[model samples]
Structures are given as C-alpha cells and as structure tokens.
Target: MTQSLAKRVEQIAPFQVMAVMARAKQLQAQGEDVIHLEVGEPDFVAPKAVNDAGQAAIANAQTGYTAATGLPELRQAISDFYQTRYQVDVAPERIIVTPGASGALILLSSLMADVGSEVLMPDPCYPCNRNFLTQVGAQARMLDCSANPDFAIDLDTLAQQWQAHTTGLWLASPANPTGSVLSKEYVAKAWQIVQQQGGHLLVDEIYQGLVFEGEDFTALSVSEDIFVVNSFSKYFAMTGWRLGWIVVPEWAVEGATKLAQNLFISAPSIAQYAALKAFDQDVLAECEARRQTLASRRATLIAGIERLGLPVAASPQGAFYIYVDVSSLTDDAMQWSLDLLEQEFVALTPGADFGQRDAHKYVRFAYTCDDARIEEALQRIERFIAA
Candidate 1:
C-alpha cells in the first residue's frame, strides 16, 4: 500500500479521442446512430493480398520472433519501395520493422531522449508523439504552427524556436489534425539545420501514401541522416496488424537494434510477413486507388464544413483530417465535441488533445470513414448547429 506509481506516470495525458470514441460506442450500444469522424484509423480492410498473406502465415505457423531489427525480406521490400516510389535508395540494413509506429517512436525516444532532452514539434501534431517523448522524461516543446499557412513551419520559425535543450525535432508529413505536408526544400533545410545544431530530426511518415495535394515527398529522399517512422496502419489499412517501420541513419542502426531488442523483441510475426505483401505491385495499386478515394472524401468534408461556417484553418494537403477553427461556434472545443456527440450523435475530436496553443478554438474531423458516414456526420453537425 505504501508503494505508489511512478511520478512520471502522472505526466502522461489521456488520449481524448479514445474517450470521445467511447461515448460514441456507448451511443451505438444503445441503438442510437452515431456517425464517427474522430478516430484516425482508416475504415477499409487490408488489401486481399495482404490479408491472404497474413492468413497464409498463420496457416504455415510462421509465428516466431524475428531479428530484433526486422524480417530481412520485409526490410528489403521497404528499401526497394523507396527506390521505386521516391527514387531513394535506403539500405535494408537501416530499416527496422516495429510493432507499430508507436513502437518505432518508443525505440527512438528511449535511445535519443533523456531527462533534459527537448523535442521540438509542431503544435497540433499527433499527440502520442509527445507522450512517447514524455515517457522518457523528455520535454515536448510544441511550436505554434496553427497560424501558419498549411500549418507549415518556415526556416525562420524553426530557427527561432531551436532551444538549448532541444535534442530532437519531430515532424509529420501530412501532419495530424492539420493534415499538412512539409516541402522537400523544407526537409532538406531542416535536416541541415538539425545536423549543424547537433540534434536529430524525426519525420512521422505514417500518412505518407495518403497525400492528396502538393508534392508526395519523403524525408528519406533528402538524406539518410533523418529518422523516419512509418506504418502500415494508414495507407495499407493495417491498424489491427500492429505493424510499422523506422528508417534510422546507418550509423545509428546498431544502437537502434539494441533498443528494439530491449523494448520489443520483434514486430508481430504475422504482421511482418503480411507487410511483405503490402509492397506488392497489386497492393501498391490498391493503396493508390484508396488515396484517390480519400482525396474525394476530403473535398466532400471540406465543402460540408464550409457550408457550416466553421472553416478549416487551411484545406489539408494530405492525411484525412481537417482542423476546423471552432472559435466562431464555440471557444471550448472539448465541450462542443461532447455536446455534438450527445445531442446529434456526431463523434469528432477536440483540439485540446493536440496542444495548448489556441487548442480550445479548434476541432479535428477525420474523413477515414466512408462518404456515406461522412455525409451523415455532416448532416448531424448541421442539425446540431441549427438547433
């Protein structure tokens, strides 16, 4: 009884999206119609070939721990994919298949972040990234980018925010909430800046293939000096598979492998094999088709939000989210989110989950569901606002 939880455990913030999802689920259980736009995972199932590969792996009983780094074959596939898709040649040795993007992040934060470490990330980023760094006693210094066009960080902004304790910078292409993409020029310059300053740069490319507008650039194309965290969860629709990968600089591969060994013995065995199929031509084509579908979904959702008068800060360039400025409707997004769910059975995420900079003035609507559900959610929002 005298023993207590670690004091740092208190520092971990709860994911508000999950709580909103819970209420939505409760409404569903009670036979009420709840149109979901809060959760980030795609509604599509894994491509048939990918699913078949998983089934085959299970049938073959190929379920055992792989190299702490990853299955050699899957790593090579990812490498080949970079060459084919982005003209970037990343050696297979540098790729680390992980349990999920979160696992890759855990490995990164554990090895790179320390008690006095500071990770500079854009405001309204994927919140879990901050949590991962926090777990390692690293401070997440969120720079307010909500006001920037496309929420993109300029060289000056990043330079000004670079602090003495800043050991790493985390960025997302097709960033969360805002769904904005950073340019190739920005990545190259940022890479140069971080290295010159003796810090590391981490790019979350989980939303890589889901880009709709602007250049579908990969940080890997810039240089191998960057750490890139990617997932099958987004483009491949493999959220439940719990699979992702990280590309570390060649020099850091051994250290990363050691941490991966301690943190996660290996990625899910079946997932590793299944993800191999995700790199197939047919699978890649299917993912591209899905990207087009999401582009359409984005336009539909953006149009509907405009009609409601809660305009998006900027139309998102990628990812399936719109960070709507809710200041016009309500200053407190959390309460507004809860009320919308309870009143009109429309579920969405409040901006408070992302960061403190004007967080109360925004809400994120994910278009991961189908057009029908998205349209329904819009109708519900219209009804809620009208009433």
Candidate 2:
C-alpha cells in the first residue's frame, strides 16, 4: 500500500537502536530487569528552575509564536552565555533558535545541499547527519576516520577528499559514539583548509558542556563563518522539550531565517521560554553536577571494558558513549546486541547504525545512566562473555 512512497524515504535506514530499544521494552514488560545502555539520552531531567520556568510560561499564556529566527531575548541570552562562558562574542542576530539540533541541521542541509553536491563527514558520525543530507538529494560522503585515535578530522585528509561538487564538510566536537573532541588549533586549521577549498564547514557541538578531557572551544570562536549546530538535549537534559539552536554566520542568517519560517515557522514557544532559564547560574550548576555524575559512570564503564579485554575504537574524551571493537567476539554487532538483551538483559547500540566502517565489528555503550546501572551492565557483560 505504501509502494508509492518517495525513493528518499525508502533509502533512509532504520535506526537499529530503536529496534533494540523496542525489544528491551518488551523484555521489561515481561518483568525482566533489562538494563539499557544503548540510548544516548541523559538520565537527568532539566533543572528545577527550567521546569518552573516552562510551567510559568504556560500559566502566563506566553505561548505565542516567536519570530522565524527566534525570540530576540533567548537569542541574546545565548549570546551572553557564549560571551561569559567561552569568551566569544556572538551577536544575537546571528543566533537562530531551532526546534532541535535536528531542525537546525535540516535548515543547514536545505540551504547548503543540492543534487550532485556532496558533503564530507566522518564515518561513525551521528547517523542522522547522513540521513539529513540524503533527504536533500545530496551525497553524504562519510570518510573512514576510525584510524584516527582521537577521532579528530585530519585537515590534510579533508583536503584530499574535497571534490569538485563538494559543498562542505560536517564535523562534531566531542562527537557521538566515541565522544572525541577537536582541539581549538585543529578546528582553526580545518576551517582554513575548507575555506581555501571554497567549501563550507559545519560543526555539531551538541555535546559542548560535557567535555571533561580536552580543550573546550566553540567553532564560533574559530570564525563567524562556521555554522554551528547545538542542542539542549544532551548537556541541558531537555530532549523531550525539543529545543536547540544554530549559530549561522551574519551573511547566511537571512537565508537560514527564511528556511526556518517556512519549514518550522518557529520553535515551541514554551520550550523557548524554558530554555531562557537554562543559562541561569543555579541551573548551570545543576547541569555541571549531572556532568560530573556522567564522568564517574564513564570511568566505571571504561575500566570494565578494559578488564573484559574489549578494544576501544577511540578514546572517548566527552559525551556519554564509548565505542568498542567487538570483532573478537562476534562478526555481527546488531545480532550480538540483540542477543545481549535477550540473554544478559543488557542493551547497547551496534556500529552498523552509525556507518559502514567495519560496522559489524563495533558497538557503542552509553554511560548516561547511573553508576549503579553502569556497574550492573558491566557485570552482565562479564558474565555474558564468560559464558
């Protein structure tokens, strides 16, 4: 009955994690104590202040649509956040509040991609990045960056991969799965190389605040020309709120705004008001506390994986995930993930969901849960491996 669906929709791959998540749900319904480690969502909720602000917005009837770009006050709040936190002065007009980082990426792809044009990105990147580019009929050329220990993009490698129809390169700092972050020096140089090639550079820094290991710098600091995608989902614990923002260069703000006006009209008014409180000092302190908890969980998971002799694909510097090479144990990570859930009651994400770089050999474990859950998941892994 749905054979008439568009070819692009058919080309979109199913998110294998959701399948695993569904199975985990079924197990839970059956009264099984399934420990979930597959999902990337933080277990923390938004700060109490943020919650109160959202409720207050609804009570005050502050639910009208904002400008296509965003509420000027929220944009200015983000600007102030940047200036105070990063020492980077981003003008309010350049900031575009989005429905979520997903929306932000769509706006970017719509503006930048065209048929026959390609965008370069690292393999094992956020899977949705490829899908977003695909929806626009643009080529999502995922380069194999698994060989890079830190998971940072190589400027020289990027230069070699630039094609005649290449429109830009998309990258992430403190990226998903491996949680690898790029240094400020690397980003500055990468920007130079891409600029020289006459192509744009899009940076996904959705996991900005959780960076515990390396230098934390925004692509915005590198230059105003960089298009940055950020979200409240990870660090701010606002996934369900569906809020995010994009920092576009001054020259492209109008184009971005027009797309936003048509595609989304505006981000949720209530969420926008709530996110304004996310920059509050007390709220930020709570987010920091959550980050520290995640850091502890990360240590526990990494040590357990090491003890099990599983090879880490990359040293995770931030974010909640750790990419592991499981080829020694199984050739199909998806099947292995399913089996682990069914037998050990521990769920994880397979690499196939992320990319084609030895996709069957890798899986990602997210330590976004509590330390106790992390410990329990590791024990299950140990037992499962021993058996």
Candidate 3:
C-alpha cells in the first residue's frame, strides 16, 4: 500500500520554471543551443577571498556545526554591516543565522503565523512566500498591486485588507521577479500601519546591494520592530553556499534561536566562515562591479523589448529580472514560454510562477547571463516574435 502524503503538501503549487529549465537542460545535452533566462541566480563565481576562507576552514578541520544562533563574530559582523552599509544600528543578539533566506522565511512564518491566521502580501509576489504560509497552515492574502508607482503596497490597500484574522505582512525590497525596490518613506508608513494594527512586518532584502537607479535603504532604517531577512546569495555570489541571516525584534530572539536549533541547528559552518570575508574591501568592490554589469544588461533587455513593441509592465530598478507584458503576443504565457523553448530554444520564466493575478499575460526575464548573451537573447526573441 502507498503512504498518504500530508494534505498541506497537496496545497503547494509547483515552481513552473523548474520544468522549463529541466527541458532546456535536456535540449542542451542533445547539442541544441539554449539560452537560459529562467532561473533567478547569478552566474558569477564566489569572491576569491570567500572561496579561500572556505578552503582554509576545511584545512583547519572546521566542519563541525556552529551555535544555533551562529558564530558570535559572524553575528557581530552582520550587525556592523547594517551600521556601515545601511547606517542603522542592530544589536548582534537579535541576529540569527539560517541556512538561507528560505530558511529565515520558514522560521518567521512558523513563529509569526498560526493556523487560520493570514499573512498579507502583494499580488505577483515571489510565489514561494505563499507556499511558505501554506506550509504553516496560514493563508497568503495577495492584494492587487500595480507596477505603476513601482509595485508598492499603499496604506489604503493595507487598511482595506485589514481583518480580524490578519496576523502580519510579508514584503520584499528589490523584490524578486519584478525587481521593484520599495522606498524608505513608503516602507516606514507601512510599518506604522502594521504597528497600529498590532501586527508584524517581515521584509526580505536579499537583493540589497544589487540596487542600480535609486537610493538603497533597509527596513532597519525605518524601525527595529520589523523583521528583516538577507542572504549571501545575491550580493556575495554565494547561492550554492546556502547561508543567510535574520534580524528579529528583541522579544523574538529567544524563540527564533530555539527554532533554529531545532529546525536547522546551524547554517553551513564552512560557508559561515567564508562569508566573514564578504565584507573585505576587495570582495565588495568586485561585487559592485558585477552590479554595474547587471544594470547594463537590464538596460539592454528593456530597450530591446520595447523596440520589439512588447510592453513592460514595470521597470526594474534592482535585482536582475524584468517582468514583461506579453498579452499582445499570447494570453497564456505558460504555453507561449513552452512553445518558445521548443521552437526558439530560449528559456524564459512565465509569470505563472509568480502569482495568479493576470499571471498568464506576463513573463519574467532574468538577465543572469552575460551582456553578450543577453543581447543574443534579444535578437533571438525578435526573430521568434516576427516568425
């Protein structure tokens, strides 16, 4: 007899792009040329200092698990990073290192939300957020958000959605898929509303250093009551290393640490040691140079898409993706993406992976590859559209 799976497992929706990526990989193995813009990870290698540190840790036999809250020095470094980078002061004790931003989200959702409670988010958000809420038996409430005014959640929308069962709000800066960075004033105002309602606000700033066009600010600059999660993945080019940390309000520190101990024990020990060098001047300078490259690629894709007469729903200020309006081309972006991959050998993520609000009319293009490849993708897309 087959074992029955948990009901919650069934409620989770698949990340649609993984299937597209798998098919693209299969085609690549068969000697077909495929351009991959479906994934959201960077194509850069880890900083030299970071990789060296990892090797040194291994040479020194430092593979043991760390403290549940992480190394004290690492936590202090993260706290100091907030001070120097964002000009905000955060106590080291309030920081808890996790396996990744995903781990931090799981910890927050588990602690902050309970069965029958609701977590408010904006539509066309990072889809895993909803799945995270679902895993905790909480509802993911998506409010209709527009790309105009930069995909922000206004005070009025928050007020209208406020309900007896609403537990908190989950947000992102330099948000995934859309790459819209919410402004400091806007985030402060939203924090005030959440405070008035006696609820928590969690902000994911994983793409903090990747900002290009506007001022970059962390939620800590607004108020310390809000929860902030960041990772070494995006800015440090350490995705495979799987290390991230969370900034919790002082009251939640004990509980968060206890949960970390039980759920993850600690983040990767080698990765933790390696990330200590992430703040080195040389490493940071290299990362900044890569940021410029990403900005140029963003410009290339946006201009090319516009030249092809395809509408862009919003302009991405940070991160590496452009959420495009493909309604003129096809009502079903999923099918269109599949057909594009099969016919054009170009892998683009359909907006269906993000959310359900007119998702079929939009697709997310990640300029994770080099500028030359991004230009080539534009040329191929133009030919595909014309054909």
Candidate 4:
C-alpha cells in the first residue's frame, strides 16, 4: 500500500497552470492542435546578452556555489535596479537571491509565520501565495476583491482582516490571473495599516516590468518595512532560469540571510551569472519590444472576447492575463475550460483555481503566445462560444 502524504502536502491544491499545460502538451503529442493560453510564461527568447553571460560564466568555471545571499555583483545590480526603477535606496546587503519568486514566498512565509498566525491576501490572486501560507502553518485569509474595482484590494476589507494575530500581508501588483494593479496610494494605506497592526508586508513584484499603462511602483519605495519579492521570469523571459531576489527591511536582513542559507543554500550559480547581463541596454531594448507585443495582444484579446459576448470585468493594465466572466456561457468554469480544450482546442484556467467566490463563472486566458497563435485562439474561442 502507498503511504499517505503528509497533512501539510495534502492541504495544498495542485498548481493549475501545470495541470493545464500538461493536458495541452498531451493533446499536441497526440497530433491534436491545441492553443495554450493557460500558463503565464512569456514566448519571447532570453536576451542575447543574458545568453552570452551564461556561456561566459560557464567557460570561466563560475559553477561553484557563491554566498547564500548571492553574488556581490548580482546583488549590487539588484540594488541599482531598485534605485533606478523606484528611486528607492536599497542596499546590496538587503537583497537575498533565491530560486525564483516562488522560493522567495516560501522563505518569507517561513520567516514571518508562527503556527496559527494569519496571512491575509486578495482572492482571485496568485494561488501559490495561499498554498505557501498553508505550508508554513499560517491561516490563509482571503479577502474577495471586486470586479468593478478592477480586482484591487479593498482597504475596508483589509482593515477588517487586520488583527493582532495577523503576522503578514501578501500582495501581488499587476497581479496574476486578473492582472490587476494596485495604486500607489492604496499600497501606502495598506502598508500603514499592516505596520500599525504589527504585521509584515510581502509584495510579489515578479511581473514588475510587464506593466502596459501607468507608473509601476515598488512597495519599498513607499515603506521600508515592506519585503519586495521579484524574479527574472515574466519581463526578462527567464522562467526556466529559476532566479529571483528579495529585498528585506534592514533589521530582517540578517534573519532572512540565515533562512536563505539554510533553506536554498544559494540560487543557481549559473542563473545568477547569466542574470548579471539582464540589465544591459541591448537586453532592455529587447524586453521593451516584447512588452509592446504583449500590449498589442492584450488589445486583440479584449476586442475578441468582447465580440464573443464574454464580459471582461476590468481592463488589465499590466501582466498578460485577461480574467473574463463566462457565466453566460457556463457556470462551471473548469468544465467549460475542459470542453473548450476538447471542442475548440483552446486551453484556459478556471477561476476556481484562484478563489471560490463566483469562480465557477470565470476563466483566465494568458496572452503569452505569438500574435498569430493568439488570433487563432481568439477565433477558435469565438466559434466555440457560438456553438
């Protein structure tokens, strides 16, 4: 007989993106044409400078482990990035390089949560944030966001959830799935509340560079108590690189460093070396081009979905996801998504994977594919809806 999994492991839900991608791959392998729009990975290639840096690092035998906090140059680069992008004075020593933004979440949860402590996050947000909280033995409190409000966190609801036992708050601006961006004013207000309640704030900025409109703000720029987590995945087109960093408050730096050493050993040495070149002008230009492409895809997708009579609750200003309400088509988003996969050969993520509030009526589409593929998928979806 197979041994039962640990209770902690059993409590976590399966990652929905992986499940959808696997099904899409299986269909493709069987010679079935499938348009995948479920996974939030960029279709762009890594910048040539990044590739060259990786090759150079390997040639120079930079394969051995560095400090758990990451290479000094990479850390300094990260600091400079924060300084340049957000006008925040971040010291290099405050940065901790990790496997990915996911890794940083794990580390943050472990560092912040005591058993039975509560961590509040927005509903229909990144599902992994909730799962990571559970794994750390923290109560994951979901605050349902309004579609009319562009799925942004409501300050009133957040204040209600701000209790003495609330040890942390997890926020994802230009959030996953919904692609909602929090305003600077709102972020500042929320940070003040969390600080007043004696809790830490963790901002997941993995999609920091993917904004299409308005200015992107880092939480650190607003408050020093905030722990900013970012990755090279989305904007840098380095998902497989599995490299990211966290900027902690000055006092928490030593504790976070120790946790990084104990938990991750160090981020992949080769990825760190490669990411050193991620800030070069040539690479920046390439990433900017990709951003423009995503902006175009977003416009195309919104128009297509509207034509199909599907309701997009809000216009996403950042990230490449369009969270749509498909209640008119079907109430069961999972079944609707599966039926679309089988009938229309298009893969999407059910909103249930993000949260339970009216989730059955919603579906999320990722516009990470090329323009041609996106157009094809839109046509297929239109046909499927007509049927």
Task: Write one digit per residue (lDDT tens) for candidate 3, span 1-387.
Answer: 999999999899888888899899999999999999988886899999999999999999889999999988999999998999888999999999999999999998998998999999888788989988899899898877754455667676687688999999989989888888888888888998999899999999999989987778999889888999999999999999999999999999999988999999899999999999998889989999999989888888888888989987766888888888899999999998988999889999998878777889988999899878888888988888989
Q: What is the Cα-based TM-score of model 3?
A: 0.98
Report how far off residue 307 is in candidate 1 (Å). 1.3
For candidate 2, the C-alpha RMSD (Å) to the true structure equals 1.2
Which segments of candidate 2 are over 4 A away from where they belong?
A: 1-3
- Distance from true location, Cα of 158 in model 1, Å: 2.4
**lDDT tens digits, residue span 1-387, model 1:** 598989878999887778788999999999998887888877889999999999999999999999999899999999998998999999999999999998999999987888878999877788888888888888898887766787666667577777888898888897888888888998999988888888999999999988888899789889888999999999999999999999999899999999999889999999988899998889999999999999888889998998998778865999889899989888798999999999999988999988888989989998988888888888888999889
Question: Against the true structure, what is each candidate's TM-score?
Answer: 0.97, 0.98, 0.98, 0.96
* Consecutive 10-residue window with the lowest summed lDDT within model 2: 146-155
Error of 4 at 44 (Å): 1.3
Better of 1 and 2 by TM-score: 2
lDDT per residue as tens, model 2, 112-222: 988879999888789999889889899798888767766656677788888899999999998887888888888899899999998899999999999879987899998
Clashing pairs in 2: 174-181
Clashes of each: 0, 1, 0, 0
Candidate models: Cα lDDT each:
0.88, 0.90, 0.89, 0.86
lDDT of 2 at 50: 90
Spell out the clash pairs found in candidate 3: none
